[model samples]
Target: MKFKALTLGILIASAGASQAATVNEVFNGKMLGTNQRYFESIAGVPRDSFRNDHTFVVQNCQITATIGDGKVTALRLDLGQGCEANLQSFIGEDAPKPGQTITPGVFGSGQRYTASCLAECGNAADPSAYALWQAPRSAGGMEVLMEMVLAGDKAMTAADEWEKQIKQAAGMDYVLATKFNCETRFNSIAEAVFKDVPVNAITVGYGLPTQRCN
Candidate 1:
């Protein structure tokens, strides 16, 4: 009986320790202002380093931290295949879904903006790729951005096809209308196509705009 009780206590302690190492717990709180050396002590030596950005693998999740002025400014986590379990752990139950109006303060950030195409809307010169949601200039000057992938090689093929159809039906008189119309149409299609797909990557920036949210 005594031996069994001792073993049970040890098992419980081990489980607690394992839970403490989760992605969220390891990366959350007071991380924005920390330095590279301090981050490496917890995240281990980076597998790749480029300028101020360092990529490290923590619990199979690829986390890249951007350091500026010797302090960490941003973190981008690529939750690829086999890292699905960590998704919920990192973002919690408020993970943004397709076509859903993301609640502000979801990631402890302020206002959120959704970009229909991968790039700026109404920009015909830019290629439409994926969908992105950005929450810039949040509390403590932090920014949060999320990305979702679209299907197919070109990804913009559907958007292009729709644009051509609109132009054919509306003629040159409606050339200006095609821009906003196609943008909205492409957003709907992207939402449907990636409804069941999870966010590919999430980036959190501190004190600056990582990707043009404003």
Candidate 2:
């Protein structure tokens, strides 16, 4: 279920699609629109790399992320069932404006921060997508990963349920890199609605890099 031998370091470095955007370039407010694409995490890799967060509603169909340097290095997204219909049903009204200070977790204003969450979407710049470029790592630095779904209304009960479910059945469904004996280290994400489509959950995982690809 994982490309344990896939080396993101190398894969992301070269073989990028003529149209695929870079990770750092994508996450830093350069939100991707429809018909856009990012670099593949691995070459010839199957797109079945999906997992559930709460074992209920969040289904990660595909994901692409970048890890390294101090920067978060990429953009993110999450899709769920029934999301292909309107796409705008989930884009809530509230979004973070520039110069806005929104803190997502327990870290100080220093180690804890987020990039731009709003940049004028195709319709009205909805809070359609918000992802963690980095997370608190266990080794000695930041952590973060990319995965998606949680597309219901922003209910604390639903969020709490998803969190509890993920914690209860962590690695089994939402795993990062199990090869380097790494554990999913990324956490704390915001609701993302694409073109009005609804998303349900997100999880960032970081622990180790994939083995270098040929």
Candidate 3:
């Protein structure tokens, strides 16, 4: 009986480690949930004939997540290319309702706006995670933003700016296409990045979004 118990414990621990190992490989030891941010500016012709040229300033330019207690709890990454179909899987939580206005500046004061279900992904639970569509409500490249926390840490906080920027740009947001849930967000992240990352390596989540100029 003792031997059996010992063997089972070993197997369980090994399996747990194996799961995180996949997610761990990508960072190569840098740290999973750090707040280090990346962003870029993408310019484009106006989607509307009368509108000015557009500038999409994407942030956390690369997919990155927060790690806590050796698990990936949160995520931040672009939602396009091979990353599109799987947006919901990573959500790990329910998504917000479509047309839900994720007002900016919870602590500070700004009225920037970003619309979720602006396209589609899954049922949102967290209220912050989003999968956006393209111009005229097509599949604009997608992206995911989540929260993170270490074990024993208090509740996690989102990295997004609270002040409103979008509406301030003289525009309100609406979902052009689909809505999403947490799992869908998770799956999408799984599809977006370098494949070697082990599953469940992240513990907490965090997110900061980019701005668009049109």
Candidate 4:
């Protein structure tokens, strides 16, 4: 009986270790620069493949890998709304929730705005509320981009209210609006815009240098 119990404990420990290893390989950017053969070995054959891009489902997250020169150059994990729990578990207790202003260096070595231009200067596709993490070279040189969705009716209502206020303050001139500034406006009402918002997607890119968001 004692021997059986000891063996069972060993088996359980081994299983847990194996699971952790797999999770690290999949989620920690270890596979970022690996070749296709190595990627398949860890992630198994992808459910879908198109040219250099391969898509796989791991831990309920849809991950897409883009290959270049026979090595994975980029990875994107889409958690969607349903995988919030999974994301929380993976990112830990400090993970940013919708409407909360994410602190710098929370998800990567550095954090920055997601848009290429300031809020009003950018086109409709520009994301108003999102964070970017560019990891150091020692940490795989991958860019981690996380984006959030607003919290239903309340978020919309808050946005409408802000727009009204902005119009009042900045008037009808686009040039006047520049004085409001993206960072300043974002800092003022980040909580209202992103309150309880869950991250729906994360994209990781390897060999990508950090560029100034002009």
Q: Write the per-residue lDDT of candidate 4 for residues 1-214, one digit (tens) a residue.
A: 9999999986776556445534335654456678987776666658898987788766656777888899888776666434322223223343445434333334533355432322354345533335565555554344556654333454445444555565665664622343333444433443344433445566667444232422
| Tens digits of per-residue lDDT for model 3, 81-139 | 32211222323123223223221111122112232322223454322222232111132
RMSD after CA superposition, every candidate:
10.8, 20.0, 20.2, 10.3
**Candidate 3, poorest ten consecutive residues by summed lDDT:** 37-46
Clashes of each: 0, 23, 78, 6
Ranking by TM-score: 4, 1, 2, 3
Task: Give per-residue CA lDDT, model 1, range 38-150, as digits (tens).
Answer: 76666666789999888877687888888888888877777555443222322334444433433222333223323343322444544323333433233333345555443
Q: Give lDDT tens digits, candidate 2, residues 156-203.
A: 333334344444555433322111112233222222211122233233
The estimated TM-scores of all candidates read 0.50, 0.24, 0.20, 0.51
Of candidates 2 and 1, the better by TM-score: 1
Best by lDDT: 4
lDDT of each: 0.52, 0.29, 0.27, 0.53
TM-score of 3: 0.20
Which scores better on lDDT, 2 or 4? 4
List residue ranges in candidate 2 displaced over 4 A: 1-60, 65-79, 82-125, 129-137, 145-152, 155-214
